[model samples]
Target chain A: MNYKASQMSQSKKPDADASRSKKIRQKRIGDQLRRLYDDVTNEPVPDEFLSLLEQADKSSKQK
Target chain B: MDDQAFKTELAELIPHLRAFARSLCGNATAADDLAQEAMLKAWKARASYQAGTNLKAWTFTILRNLFYSEKRRSWRRQQLDPEVAEATLVSNDNPSSAIELLSLRNALDELPEDQREALILVGAGGLSYEETAEICGCAIGTIKSRVSRARKAITEILESKMSGLTGNDSLSAADAFEDIMRQADELSRDLPADA
Candidate 1:
């Protein structure tokens, strides 16, 4: 699909102001997504998943 | 690979697996269910797992597949539930940061599944473009485009919501716009003059 070609063309066409705004927005979004990622990753693993893994290990040992 | 080593790797990957699952589903309960199911599936197929390959990618592939399959089933169930349909229109009344995060999550949930997956895999999961492409079964360019589009969509949605909130409330839209413009100005100033 020549995705890179199209993307490059789009970037080259945008003027400095437009491109600057786009970059700013992209950076802001990246920061927000990083925060969201941190929030999710820092959460403790639920006990059910730990119990489930133990069960799986025991059952696999029986096989 | 020894079973003990493999088990340790899997255990260490559980948090990331859950993070990916949560990013995919946006519901803690459903994410845990998906993660647990994927872990069980990975354990069952551990014999087929190659020694040196990326286990995280392999397990993520399994979880993504399971999520899609379950989504297909739940799509039908949601169609039959009036409450599920109604929930789409309900908005968070509180405009606190917590509510803003909820709105951000909702915006993410609204993105096309492929774009959301690409964005999360790269932005959150710390996977390389090549790794994400391998997991998604697409070219690296496609993954890049997906992530770019996802970022744009999320930013636009959040900006519109922010402007909307500022327009009617204590905060002024002009101030919000000025803040964004100031940020953009700083970014532009940091750029090289010629290019």
Candidate 2:
């Protein structure tokens, strides 16, 4: 959904410093979050999770 | 969906579920437990899942609900010190990335649970606001506000830390800070705004 902030900002004169700083902060945080997400996502799937899936598959077959 | 298709979709979503769980719980072990539990729950409820719907969001909703329920239970057992939780999550390998990640994690941990969840669902999980709002059980506007507040809070935290440091540390921090700020500034300028 389009954020109200983005919508409201469209109709008003932008405050240079405030908007600039806000954008910088948002981008920096986004970058860091992406790194964290990737780090976690890239980790190898553990053996236990594999076993759990196996068990699930077996159980579903029995059903 | 057929059971085979359901299983395939569920398998594909496990990595994302695990990653999001890790972000929420901040500990690898707990994250794994949460992910495992969520998978089991999803498997049990697979019949309810509609065909051609967003399986990832459905699993996320299950995982998030489990996390919150577990969080409530843990809170009753003992108060968890955020600093202690963070220390356990931070790794010593790759000093630079570790430090940056630690700070980012700390900042994320500082956010209210709703705001953090909203930010993670949208920013990190790459889910649309509509999906996040559905997962969060809130209006789309509320999700946006939560994300906005979360970003603002994280920026303040990192900015304060950057300002507090000196010499070489400050230089590196400033460099990263300025790089993002410049990009953001340019982006803002490119977007249409009333003169």
Candidate 3:
């Protein structure tokens, strides 16, 4: 009976630890994805993007 | 909105569109081309946009639709060079890239297109579930489930890359965290600094 009780207690710790680590894992994934995304967002808007729009506007003026 | 006002707002959204495009396509050059196309489309379609609604979401929907349509067209073309395409896929799986955290890009690339977009829209793009559903043209519940599954899948992929990863994945998951950190350092140092 005592062995069974001790085994249950030992198993319970893993469950707690697993949940804790899962949260940590999720936090890391979110952080990394946000960082990856933010890096691109922070980059200077390439010159072509604005140039393309300016060209489109110029052509539309002809119509 | 007037023509100038519409153009100004669309310009401001270009950086975000590029960011979102990069997440969708993983290749910077292709993603930039996609973003430019979407920006042009949004500009041309400005008459249809409601003045006070969520313009960001509207632009994102345009970008997402363009991406999927282009992806479909590319898939049709790729039948001509299946081997070449598969070779590219195999090379991407190679971890020899010297770029910081290429593994995360690879891991994100491995997700199914739907799940990857859903996760990026919600997880990275900071959209509400309702906004994501509208952008995806799906129900809110579907978006929630896709986001949850994507989170689980990313965790497994990132952990596998961090560990030396034998075939058995469960063992790695159940292993201690310190081992993975040590492996990460070792893997990072293997490539030459300049490479």
Candidate 4:
């Protein structure tokens, strides 16, 4: 019984390895996309827009 | 900006920025502020934005700049007190899963800011080493070392935390990390294409 159990566990290792490898690949892809998303939203309004807004605000203040 | 143009950009990037901000700031308040600041900066810099270049990468550069430049980081460091550490995983719904995730987040939070940023950018955020180097304003080797050390520290903490919590030692700690990798993979599959 002990020998059989050991063999069963040994055989299972490959299955586990294959599954884990797949996960690593998926994580890599997911991580890339996540960074892409972060970059996009990180800057909501570019500096140009902010300058324009500042100018408008100043003009209104003068008015 | 025209309604259509603003809508298009918002639709394309808001969710991602939210995720990135959440990871860095740990809660909605700071996350929103970080994202908002990044956006304001991006808008001001719009004229310099090259049309064919990656917009997302440019935006992250802006956000990271703001994060490092602000004096508020000192205050933010205090906010990361051990008292608030317990709250890290309370937001998780499942007890068992929450404990594991909370423990992980707490351990991550405990890391030095540079190490933490390195791990999040590469481990969770998924940037290539080159991209990470660009974002961090460091050499590629530095990025590699930082990420390696960050993972080692996290793994050590996770192993210790799990040891006392669960009586069963059926699988080793290495196995546990593999399991997490698998779950992350599954999450990738389940996530929306845009996500």
Candidate 5:
């Protein structure tokens, strides 16, 4: 009974460690994605595009 | 169409859409334009978008179609090879630390458009092969093949780049820290430095 308990404890420890490591990796990847988003969004929206979207919105409103 | 509802849905998707576009286009300016064009297309085709379906996948399909259409019609036929450009960028200072990361990005950049799109949809967008196939308007088997090819090509490129670095036995904990710092620096350009 004691041996079984020790064996169970050993398996449990690895699972816990794996979960912790997975969380860390998840957070790191999430942070990288967030950073990529920020970089992409911070750039100036092109003039032709801004004008095009404005025209698009106006056309929709007229309908 | 309910303007408020459309806006809310679009707001939620902008970041993911941008990431997908950027990954496809390999740069910021082109990606923003691609994403904006996609949103416009989505807005115009709002009636076709069935409720409860994948908005991100819909937007991705629009962007991919637009990108290919533009490429086909454009007069500037000679495009700069992204892999070669990436390779050129590798001769920067501190090659010891940043080489692996830069090479990986370069390998990704070097991928064929279809394979890159598949990898981004699966690896980055967290979409399954079925969803990716749907977005790309291809078969599930095709999507799987593209992703497999992309991973293999990228791994090959990265391994070749790292071969020399592996010989240097002095890659210590400090070197690892330097790599993290280098990545953080590159990442800072992509986000608010404070973030």
Candidate 6:
């Protein structure tokens, strides 16, 4: 990590400000990723998924 | 494991399987189809699975293998365009969160398949590096570097887009970062498993 977004800009912000802003940005991205994942995980496991499992179970026993 | 025990475990892991599939393909319908196929495959291969191992990791490996093989077979990079994918995956109820997720999803698309999968597995799928490396069929250090580079790349992409940085500076900066990544990759290839 270069730890400096300020390098790309002409603004003369201090290094500490640049570092803290980078950290905040990273934290936001991490949280956003976890939320994206959990949104799908939190969805109602479609009925087809449940029935498919049961169907497999029953057929295996019958065989 | 007994058939009953296997069924119990498989049922419990359904949501996770679906999530991993969705993240890989970015489509709800296709993801379910993939997840369902993996479940059946796992059931058929139940006898081969060692009992008391990491069942989630095993199933994840199965799902990921199915995803890639199917992808290779079809030769389709994307099942849905970005706009359609974003509209389908995110609800419009919360504008801010939707924007946040939509942008990341687009940024994630820019990464190579290896790095994208590596980042998803470690960063969001709640898997450890060893498990991720196993699932990805790569070195542990390779997974680390992919993830590290992915985070940096996404941050750079997102930040540049947000800050309205001058195109010339950002382009040059990106070129420099690419050079650094190539060097880092060469060095990481020989990194010890635990290093």
List iRMS (one decimal) for every candidate.
2.2, 2.4, 2.5, 7.4, 5.1, 5.2
Off by over 4 Å in 6: A1-13, B72-93, B165-195
Pairs clashing within candidate 3: none
Best-performing candidate as measured by TM-score: 6
Better of 3 and 5 by lDDT: 3
- Give a tens-digit lDDT track for model 2, residues B51-98: 888889899999888877765543211223466445534643544445
Q: Write the residue-wise lDDT of candidate 5 on B115-185 in tens digits.
A: 87787678667788998999888899999999888877765664454343455777665446545664475
Docking class of 1: acceptable
The candidate 1 chain B region of ten consecutive residues with least summed lDDT is B76-85
Candidate 5 recovers a fraction of native contacts equal to 0.16
lDDT of 3: 0.75
Model 5's DockQ? Answer: 0.18
Q: Candidate 1 regions off by >4 Å?
A: A1-25, B72-97, B165-195
lDDT of each: 0.73, 0.76, 0.75, 0.61, 0.65, 0.79
User: What would the per-residue lDDT of candidate 6 be over residues B121-160, giving only the tens digit for each residue?
Assistant: 8999899999999999989999999999999999988766
Residue-level error in angstroms, candidate 2, position B173:
13
Residues A1-63, candidate 5, lDDT per residue (tens digit)? 699999998888888665554454344433443433444455454565546556776798899
What TM-score does prediction 4 earn?
0.60
Least well predicted 10-residue stretch by lDDT in candidate 3 chain B: B73-82
Q: In candidate 4 chain B, where is summed lDDT lowest over 10 consecutive residues?
A: B74-83
Q: Which is the winner by TM-score between candidate 1 and candidate 2?
A: 2
TM-score of chain B of each: 0.73, 0.76, 0.72, 0.71, 0.70, 0.77
lDDT of 4 by residue, A1-63 (tens): 699999998898898766665555444434443443353345454444345445544554486
Among the numbered candidates, top lDDT falls to 6
Task: Pick the DockQ winner.
Answer: 3
TM-score of each: 0.71, 0.74, 0.74, 0.60, 0.61, 0.79
Candidate 3 lDDT, tens digit per residue, B51-150?
Answer: 9999999999999889888755332111113343344335444333212234566677778878888898898889999999999999999999999999
TM-score of 5: 0.61
Indicate whether candidate 3 or candidate 6 has the larger TM-score. Answer: 6
lDDT accuracy of residue B152 in candidate 4 = 72
